[model samples]
Target: MTVKDIATLLDAKIICCEDSLGRELHAACGADMMSDVLAFVKDQSVLLTGLCNPQVIRTAEMMDMVCIVFVRGKLPDENMIELAIERNIPLLSTKHRMFTACGLLYSNGLHGGATN
Candidate 1:
């Protein structure tokens, strides 16, 4: 799926990189802990998290993630936006709880990341 499809599926707001809505996304992983995301994610993926901090953006950058989805209606503050902007990662937020959001995307064919 593309970023626009994710935005539509989760009712998310695009916070930056509006031009990236056309980018294809192959996988997703939801997490609140940056460490776990760093250790687990393995693909050109998008992150779904409730953490809403600058560190989340940093982690996404380190993992080469293309987008971030903030769950539970959480919004990234200015610092986080700056990080995403600097990293060229698109940011989005959705009101759905993490599980429901992940499930919806997964059911639609977005896998979690590669394990090998």
Candidate 2:
């Protein structure tokens, strides 16, 4: 699905990279632990997380993720937004909790990447 589709599906607020909303993302992974994301995520372009920090953006960058969905209405600070913008990753905020958000995407045909 496209980034715009995910935003629409979740009713999320797009915080940056609106220009890239047309980008297509085939997979998603939801996690609060950066370590787990770093260790296990593979080829997932969208990240769904409750963690609202700069390191989350960094972790997404390391995983080559193109978009981030902040669950439970969590919003990243300016620094985090700057980092995401610099990395060309779109940030989205959703009122849904982590589990609900993940389920929404999954039920809509967004699958998780393979785990090691």
TM-score of each: 0.96, 0.97
- Model 2's TM-score against the true structure: 0.97
Clashing pairs in 1: none
Candidate 1 lDDT, tens digit per residue, 8-115?
999999999888889899989988998888776788489999998788998999888889999999999888888888888999999999999999999999988686
Model 2 CA deviation exceeding 4 Å by range? none
* lDDT at 44, model 1: 48
Report lDDT (CA) for all predictions. Answer: 0.90, 0.94
Best by lDDT: 2
Give the C-alpha miss distance for residue 42 in model 2, angstroms.
0.5
Give one clash count per candidate, in the order shown: 0, 0
**Model 1 lowest lDDT segment of ten:** 36-45
TM-score of model 1 relative to the true fold? Answer: 0.96
Work out candidate 1's RMSD over C-alphas: 1.0
Tell me each candidate's RMSD, in Å, in order.
1.0, 0.7
Q: Residue 97 CA error for candidate 2 (Å)?
A: 0.5
